[model samples]
Target: MGTPHSRRGNTRQRIQDVALGLFSERGYEKTSLREIAEKLEVTKAALYYHFKTKEDIVISLSQDLCGPIDELIAWAGTQPRTLATKQEVIRRYSESLRASEPFFRFMQENQAAVRDLAIGDSFKERMHALFGLLREPEAELTDQVRCITALFSMHAGMFALQDVEGDPEEKRKAILEVATELVTAANPPNRRPVRPDSAQTASP
Candidate 1:
């Protein structure tokens, strides 16, 4: 049997999962806390014990999505500016969003509700921070586009690849591959010219 604390944790995650699905299906404004409780087969009192309101649920979910991104941003800030770091940032960002794909869909379908809530603004700020880390200050316009495109491609892939065939993980990898390629293209390695041989007299 699970401990009381584990049970409470499970209930909270279950609530979040159901609420996100309900929000995605019926739109955030149309979904109610009662409906969420009913869907979870839990009493309203039980639901209230975890989340007080619909807005709170959304905020919790958004925070879950942003937490890792915030960590990534902080880590990137301390790293030396290099191509490998940018690629790893892209890679980690992709991994972070894997579990939040449904949240992305919710945001897409409920743009007005998202705008009304703080989630949109907070998410945008994180995205901007990620973009800043992806591109250098003196990058050319085309390179800048590459960096932005890489991020958006991952965003787009969650929905865009829905109709495509193959495993979800495979599709995710494909998207990551493309995004990584874009990042690499945006930050190509510097090529050092080869120095002429100074002691080639014997060879000649």
Candidate 2:
């Protein structure tokens, strides 16, 4: 039912999946491009055609996560800097992480490797971009903290609360709820008016 291009895309995705599996099972340092090739039942050259190295595979996999984030930041930019927009940003951001659960867990366990890959710093920059979207230009330090904490709760909810008792979906909802409350508090109607000109917070 799919076209040739679609099927080729599927092959690329399969290679990415097998690579992540190898990366997760064996440590990042332990996994090799050859092992990933073996697991995928492909030639080392074929795998190389798809990805040059382990770092390339890791970057490719996380690129899936990055796309939604860039989209969210872009979408939030077009919105009025209202409490509702901040809440919507939180909601969209949570949705973005839905597929990154495993990759994020790997990140926590492999902070050194992740740092080496330079992903951690890029991720922090994204968080700061989101913070810029959420915080008023003249926001007080306390409100700024609230906005930052709101973003933190959303991110930490995934990895930090993995062992918690409730359902994963429920936990996500709770985190969104908490984030929304914080954003709302930070932008009180009597105080922080939605910045009309801030519709586009930052350029792509």
In the range 1-204, model 2's lDDT, one tens digit per residue, is 222345355878777666666666787888888788888788999988878878887887677757888888988887777777888898888887765666766776677788889677887788899999889878899999999999888778777778989898999998889989999899886665565564467456
Write model 1 residue lDDT over 87-113, tens digit each, in one string. 899989988888567788999889999
Task: Tell me, by lDDT, which candidate is best.
Answer: 1
Candidate 1, after superposition: displacement of residue 98 in Å?
Answer: 1.1
* Residue 183 C-alpha lDDT in model 2: 91
Stretches of candidate 2 off by over 4 Å are: 1-9, 192-204
TM-score of 2: 0.84
